[model samples]
Target: MSDTSLLSSLLNLITTATCNLQSELKGAGLPEPWIDNASLHPWDEETPSKKYWDARRTLISALGMMTAVVQNPREKIICDDLGYHHSAALNFIVNTHMADVLAAPNVDERIGLPVSEIARRTGTHPAKTERVLRFLCMYHTFQETSPGVFANNKVSECLKKGHPTAELPLMWADVGFRSATAFSATLRDPQTAHSMRIEDAPFGAVFGNHTSKSTSESESIPKSEPGTASPVRATIFEFLSRPESEVYRSAFAKTMVTLDIMNGALGYHDLPWDRWDKEGAVFVEAGASTGHLSNDVLSVVKHAKFINQDLPEVCLQGEKFFAENNAEAIRSGRVKFQPNDFFTEQPVKGAAIYILSNILHDWPDNEALKILKHIGDAMIPTSRLLVMEIVIVPSLSQSRSPPSAPVDQNPNDAPWPLPKDYGIVNRYPHHQSMEMINTFNGLDRTLDEYVALFQQSELELVEVHRIRKLVSIMEVKKKA
Candidate 1:
């Protein structure tokens, strides 16, 4: 079809989908998600509404597809493909505390602030601040209320100090950005390219304590002992565990909380928590950082004993977290924090439910298998394992033939297919997978891979509950 015809067809499809979504939202008595001031906030604060979020996802997908078709291919590829510039700008804003400046109690939210004021408060150059703010404003993160005066919008508000998600961007823009730079090198280095060892990954190569060496020399160097203090031998987690890395460790923990928020309380939505016979049931939260997931469970699934396990330092923090947030549960002997390494053994045995949220994805298969084996050893015949993680969908091959035109569809139908594996829906996860490989030599597995992992532990995969676009709850049990 002609370019103009294709554009028209896409526009029609977007319009129809958007109208239908709006109607559904109205019927459900939810607020309209306006494009100008969209509230993509988590729905966990209220009752979990799958229908509402599903509608929102549909609208977002359609809008994304429409945007792709509307942009000039050359400009789009150049601007969108090279995202480091945007990341750098955002990193600058985060590191300099520009968002905190705008959010100060004395600052007028309506009047906004000029570049001079923002730069002064942030200790940045006025001209550079203007350029960065203008770029961010274009992306709808910050807004220019008047010429040269910027204020926080919903998007920028996320960066305000003490926000639940504030530390997430910093994690990405700092360590994530640095690790990404070494991605190309990781791919090209024969010694490291295909290696699943954490020390061989780009993140290790960049931040690791090892001395600079050529690929050949690196081969001769003895592998650093796990949990050792050697500068050259420490894994990402080990490095972060050091006394000097306390700032980064705190940020990383907060980032996990942000991830949970982003997933819209997936565990609660996907798992049948209400139906679970909670009377005297033990819920073991393995690798529970700050006890956020355990807190979620305590809020919903009452009368259950909770064990929050992690490394010693993390368990200490989790204790404080539960003390501050769920003091009643701790006071009543329903909740306890235990410091136990997953790699060592299953300290809590035969729990009714063991939750491994975002844990296995941080390790390679070899390490992941070891962790699984420990969990399996702890499981009773009736115990269920809830492995919450992203299930990556394979991408279409470039060599595959172009999608054929619909045989008998209305002309107003979407010009492009709306398959779940379409580029727009899959891109974020794909990027995440790459980051996993780069940072930890880990992976976001497909369903089959997850099943295989469970099978290795002599467990049976009962079901997979999709919680969101990038996450799922793979339910497993001891093999009958």
Candidate 2:
């Protein structure tokens, strides 16, 4: 092979290595001290500068391999080991209604549901369930306190759907929407006329549309006209929307309520209300799909107002979750709920804080801006936007410009921003997140892009904090 071809071959090896590591981390178990940082505000997960640098190095090496595949397209494997684990994890949860079964507290070990008994309750082929249980043992999502017996742990508790502590955000992103959309979508068809002008990826077909603008206006956002059929992470209608019946909807709703109650009990431990409170507080869960995040927000904030928003079609669950819960709470009087389609509407005045925790990074800038502009419009002078996100930092080893000017300077004076040379792009968690969100045309973001998004909205970056090892806290204020 030619030297260039040979170099590409070496890079391929690197990509495979990186993907394996990513999967290992996910299966390794959820981060420790998780209960402590559940409501991750800024400054929740602090570490030494050296640790950040070490992690940045590992991230760059991983992402660099993945990005190379984007351009070269040939020398790589799509489903690294992590992809397999993700599927395994989802199947594991679904079979036992793992989330529900786990929520029953000590009932399992208390009843001594050894592998045979667990199989009996779930009504599974006992031998097969035993095989799966052995897999769970390896991951320790459930603990085998004694041989043959299983019970919940911090990680297992989170598996319950609708549990606020549940990273339903993560789970829903994977099996929830992608699986459903893939039914009729052409996820890997890179040969359409639109690939040249990528705006053409069929909305229904869009799988991995992750993108970043030229760090400078000189580096323009690739042009693509808006199209119908936007991607959603997942909505509450899995039960209703699929079969198109009220019974399914009702069942899904009940599941959601059960989830909510479990999450509240498991999640109340790390509510981050004290350390970071702002003046104009509004968190527009733009793709609030069914109001799960809004429910989470309501838990932390009695004073902090929320903008629970999503597509009009998907808005019912927000109402349902609140209405069902509040009916009981009203006699008790606890939380309030509001619904809006954030893209079309969000309150934009005198706001202290606005949040898009698991938003952004979903679209190529082509669509993300419309949502950001709405968020910007809602900002008051003192308001700040708090995003609990996975920000990609640039790789430290890559050579770059000296620090004399800002890393994002423009050569052509074209109007837009670009990624900075900060070496953090790979810090994002869940290697498969890009592939999973592909079902929705949703992409991930780098720290540089977040800065640019804020700039477009005339917002300023006041502070940036890291949550756990994978998530980040970006605090921003409307620019003066």
Best by TM-score: 1
Q: Which prediction has the highest lDDT against the true structure?
A: 1
TM-score for each of the candidates: 0.86, 0.53
- Cα TM-score of candidate 1: 0.86
lDDT of 2 by residue, 1-480 (tens): 222343354355445545544454455443323322213211122222333333334445545544653654433355342445544554456535654664455564333357676777777776776666656657656666567666655556555665543444333433343343442344444343233122333333322232321121123332322342445322222223554344334434444434333313323223365444454444444555556645644555655555555555556666665676554432333323445655675754555556675666545575667777887787777666777666654433321322245555443121111123322233234442444243344556777878887788777788876432345678877788
Q: In candidate 1, which residue ranges exceed 4 Å CA deviation?
A: 1-9, 27-30, 34-48, 210-231, 396-416
Tens-digit lDDT track of model 1 for 431-463? 778888877888989888888888888999988
User: What value of lDDT does candidate 2 attain over all alpha carbons?
Assistant: 0.48
lDDT of 1: 0.73
